[model samples]
Target chain A: MKPSTVPASTPSLRQSSGRYLQTKWKGLIIAVPYLWLVLFFLIPFFIVIKISLAESIIASPPFSSLLNWTEDGALQLSLLFDNYAYLWEDELYYKTYLNSIKVAFICTLICLFIGYPMAYGIVRATPTQRNILLILVILPFWTSFLLRVYAWMGILADQGTLNNLLIWFGLIDEPIRMLYTPFAVYLGIIYSYLPFMILPLYANIEKLDMNLLEAAAALGAKPLITFLTVTLPMTLPGIIAGSLLVFIPATGEYVIPDLLGGGNSFMIGKLLYSEFNNNHDWPVAAAVAVALLILLVLPMMLYQNVQARQVGVKT
Target chain B: MIHKRSRWVIAMLCFGLAFLYVPIFLLILYSFNHSKLVPIWGGFSTRWYTVLFESPEVWEAVMLSLRIALINATFATLLGTLAALAMVRFGRFKGRTLFSGMISAPLVMPEVITGLSLLLLFITLADIIGWPGARGFTTITIAHITFSMAYVAVIIQSRLIGMDQSIEEAAQDLGAKPLRVLWDITLPILAPGMLAGWLLAFTLSLDDLVIASFVTGPGSNTLPILIFSRIKLGLKPDINALATLIILTVSIGVLLAAWLMWRQEKQRMQDRKMASRTDH
Candidate 1:
């Protein structure tokens, strides 16, 4: 191919006005999505923040901002930190936040452990079986999520199918309280999010080099050593992806905890819902949400940094 | 890696698979259970399935939900593909990074936050414009479209990124207008991604509970909302029956899609083999 004959400042080298218009139109087409996101997602987050700083009034339009204490012992227009204090100083609030993170972390660990193996197994399987297993993982996802969770209720309740089966087999003296327990809550979350964990792991681990394993064998490394030295490091990307998939959603989960968790079992998500709906306290709820966002942001930023580093290496 | 007994690995795999399948199988079995107390088998019966057919209110809700999901899925797929096309065609610009981040945000943002934000927007809109929203099914459908479109956008973007861009340029060189170039070339080429996006959005709309619970007003219960409320009150065998029906339908749809793809691939291989033979 010949190099360009035109000099850098030549008129003939300039792009046409018709092409310029097309490029500008194309730029607007790109702008539409970003504009929609700013309006819907980002602006609402600021509004939530604004309202969170306001005084809590009972059940009568929660969005009266600019708060300060008045002569009549009512709060008026100015700034305050009590809503955040309600989230932090209270033992119940801290407990709920800890509980949300605790559950999400444990669930992410379990999902990684379980889903990684299955992903590996599926990748190793014949194409037909791989397709079949993948379909099995995705099939439940296609059904209504609440209905699938409801199906768990039928299996986990005191007089549930699991108990009845145990009773028939003479394995239990009484129908166990499997429903409305923390264990039951964990079961539901793990079951629901298993597919999320599997899919990401599948995407990454499926690309792993089989020759490495063979080479390790030829080099006289034991199976376990080879696994630790080769496979785990190789699959770390998949592990991170799978963990993120499980961890992020599990943190903000409301339905599983609400249905399966009893009154004493207070996850942060449930607490936020109650504050908004049951307690009619919007400001406190917003404060809790802001705190939740803060808690998630640190780890999420770290994840992005790591991903960016990886992309930097690749490119 | 550990060189555990193959028997041990096999047993573990079997147990896990059995755990997943048995719960679902039990749900199916209980659908026909004569016992109303669910799980306890009073006897074998077809009573729950029959009960499903008798409820006109249930039918009405299902029909309404179907209508909403179809509408939401179609719009989500269309907007998602357009967004994806714009994303890929306009590859890199000043704000491309910002655009990608915006599209991915809804996928990660909590459903509670999404629902509440949408609800707040609707209320503000009513105060401003006196609009066509009491924040009912229409609001819920639109909200569903917003998030579901993100997923569709992701899928279509990946598909477009992997695709050959030369085909479109070829169409343009053959004297196609920009609109006609897209319609005759890109639309047909991206049809599979579009269809996949439609299915993804439809499933997402069907599965949504928290967002729908927030936005759905005045007696409109999608099946998930109905099931959620019912489970909170107490479990029922009819739910099992309904779930069984849904599971079966989805499995069939997936299997059909797989079979079609396999046939298409096989035909492609045959075509290649024939062409190579002709060349030889």
Candidate 2:
């Protein structure tokens, strides 16, 4: 998006009287969000880093002091690398990290598969139909995300709707154990995030110039081939945006796995929760959060770099 | 023929939409099931709805969630609009890139990390300053505003970028001050976007569970927390009833908003047509 920084105000008016007032308003406007982010967003991350370097202790607040005042009025400070070391030493942390990534990847792929066609169809729809279809896609999204995950419990449980239907049809001798499985976790993730995928994709696809596809068709290209060559390349940005939207949150997804995944499946979000709430290891939990943030941030920064390069090329 | 491929795409779309809605439909359907055991076809009954209404805890949680959502949405919209204005109106401020990154980061930042870091911040603040005394509604609302503002910022930013600057310039040329132009011309034009951002933030805060879980104090459970805690035991009919009611409320709200937007769009189109006729 292009930035419209220079407001097109009248120069004569600005020179006469509004110059001082303009700068003052601008200062106030900038200060509000700037100060809010610094105090709430930036300061919290610094605290996270500080806590991650502190020792774990069994106490009221559960983490050891980063700074200690000695009995003789001297000050002592401690920062432990032990929490970071434990992350490397333990195999489970890596596995949890990999598992989270793997699930996130699979969920992103599933969302893309399901979301692309919905977006495509909505774009192809007549104008009124397009609005209705888009609304349908977003309707479930506005409902509670937690409740949607809970809804899957009613559908995928052993005696739930799907299993009951399967058993009634004699397709299975017993109710299939579908709930509390990785399959259900994937289902829950896809169901909850489908709108996130579709909305972005729709925004891109709806604006597609149909004349390009028609020209391809006129050049004796098959519909499938035309879509593959012409449509897919144009919507690649949408695909990436949607995938990132799904993939990022899915990586640290606690609710779906916590509610749906069985004992065998573990996620970093769950691990972080247990470390803090269950084991009272605040510093370790902080370390895990720091690690997860690192895992998420590197790829995000790389994506931003690639996007900036693409925009540069375009310009 | 291309017709066959289009048919397949249409089928896929139908199946995809069905997959999306069927689970919600079942939840709504089974809400009326009289049986205590979920998913069983007990004849239709309103027992669960009545039970849900009778529960004080649910009411308390609902009220708390609404209040947080209200406050969070309002503050997020105000701050977010200001941030968007800063990015779009003020050209090259120091830390521009950092400001933009900070604004967008929370949109994709994992809730676990945000919740944990914010919790630690609150605790540290309380320890050092002895203010905020405890983590409760105020803390949760603050946390919600911190993240939800990112979403609001993106919305208003895009809206402001798309808006025509000539109108505001016209107002300024008429000797109106900068703030007056903003109030009389810019904000009125951005009203729809601001409202949309506000509603989006409200829903997001209401739906949040993880961050609230981290920040909540004693007796401060939000509805999502209440419902999630109960899920471990087993599915309850009352929870289903609660979900159904929530879904109903949301659907109605969404439909109303859509209708209003559609009407506003029509009005804009007519206004443009009338302007063109007079020009001719």
Candidate 3:
């Protein structure tokens, strides 16, 4: 180590100064995004909660304030459970919630059934071929979402392409009522979200050690047994991740259900839309939002805990 | 690796791809259909395309959507890049987990919840600060940036994780300032990831309807919002024409990007080979 004779201001001093500046820059870099998210993402969530507790009024902005000034210069607060109570009282809300969950769950299962094998096959393909297959899977994802849904309308209408094809094949006498039904809603969701399911599952399955499967096979394990015991267990995390990705968004999907699901197919998203836009009830809309948030976030909170535990074990 | 079940798996994959593409293919094909009704095949014509070109409402929506998408993609990329750097490079800072969670929340949060909460926030902010006087372009742009940033952050973070850190460290060791190192070395290497993130953000902003619907005021109709309302009434051939044009434009753009990246990779490999030969 140099003991002496080094200049005071040449390299070492400048380097330390640079390090100090770098530290300040680091703080600023992190703070920008951190503060932006807090201001925009986190604080808005609180506002939603506040609005949900307030009463809807026929006024500008359309919600009564929860706070009031008292005659004695003290503050008064009023919060209403009426919106939530109304949500509970209405049997339609219950049906909407249950229907949304049912739709989301079924769509998720369909995505898994369709996506898993594709992912498995792609992972096992030659490297060059795998890239092409992955690109093909992602191509539709880049296209306009609303347009994709609209494409289904053209294909599933009473006189749509599917019915036309079936009629031509002598499979049916009349045009089947495929559009404006729960079945169309299911088809739309599965089609839109299948890529989301496949990508994560592909990532997980691609990382698997093929030797483990080969070892099982050498030990007289059937292909089905090897897959069930090894592959399925190994990709459970991915399965859960992919399922949640599809299911959560599907639950709150407004576009697909509104377009494909006729008046009878009640979804919470469509209900929330009507509450806000048609009914002009901001508080009820907020309440619906809160209910949906809880429905989605509870599973996520549980998943987070499970993930944390898994990380802990791994470390 | 070819097994007894490989054939079944391959067949499933083929079926899945066909299922995914057939509808989109039909939509494109029918865009040029001369018939007013979709299923009945009339002789092919360019009438719908001409109609789409002449529609002022669609053009207005398209212009507005493009403007928002441009602005949203830029802001999302900048903020998302910063957030990704914070998560990847800042090590274990305080509140890192919270920071990450907030960044990722929009990824899975229902669009309805996101839109509603954001609209509420804008309303409250306007009441308190008297800014953002109305919900339209500004509010919609901000909402798009918020959610799209999460996606951009994920893309950039994955890219950062795959990158070699030694090059950046070496630049710093050679007396380059941190900012200089980032600008010169790190950013150049991250350009592809950043471009991908930008494109992703742009497409997301363009495709977004639910959030835009929540935040937009009158006269600020985005393309998706316009198409959505129109489709609710009925599907038209002009709409199909517009969709076909968009798909064509987007696919060409994607293919061009892929080709450019492939060329760049090849050039890099050739350059490395030359450098290795010179070294020997």
Best by TM-score: 2
Residues B215-261, model 1: lDDT tens digits: 77778888787777776788777877888888788778988987898
Task: List TM-score (chain A only) for every prediction.
Answer: 0.87, 0.87, 0.88
Would you list the rank order by TM-score, best first? 2, 3, 1
Task: List where candidate 1 sits over 4 angstroms from the true fold.
Answer: A1-28, A67-77, A299-315, B1-9
Query: Which of the predicted structures, 2 or 3, would earn the higher lDDT when compared with the native?
Result: 3
lDDT of 3 by residue, A1-315 (tens): 122333432233223322323466888889999999998899999998998999988899899889999899888999899999999999999889998999999999999999999999999999779878987898899999999999999999888899999999999999999899989999999999999999989977886889989999999898889989999998887788788888988999999989988777789998998889899899999999999888878877755554433333222
**Tens-digit lDDT track for model 1 on A199-253?**
8778777868889988998999987788799888987877886788788889899
Instruction: Write one digit per residue (lDDT tens) for candidate 3, span B50-118.
Output: 989998999999999999999999999999998988876766679999998898889888888899899
> What TM-score fits each model?
0.90, 0.94, 0.92
The 10 consecutive residues of candidate 1 chain A with the worst lDDT sum are: A12-21
Residue-level error in angstroms, candidate 2, position A239: 0.5
Q: Itemize residue pairs with steric clashes in candidate 3.
A: none
Model 2 stretches with alpha carbons more than 4 Å out: A1-21, A68-77, A302-315
User: Residue B122 in model 1: shift from native, Å?
Assistant: 1.6
Name the Cα RMSD for model 3. 6.3
TM-score of 2: 0.94
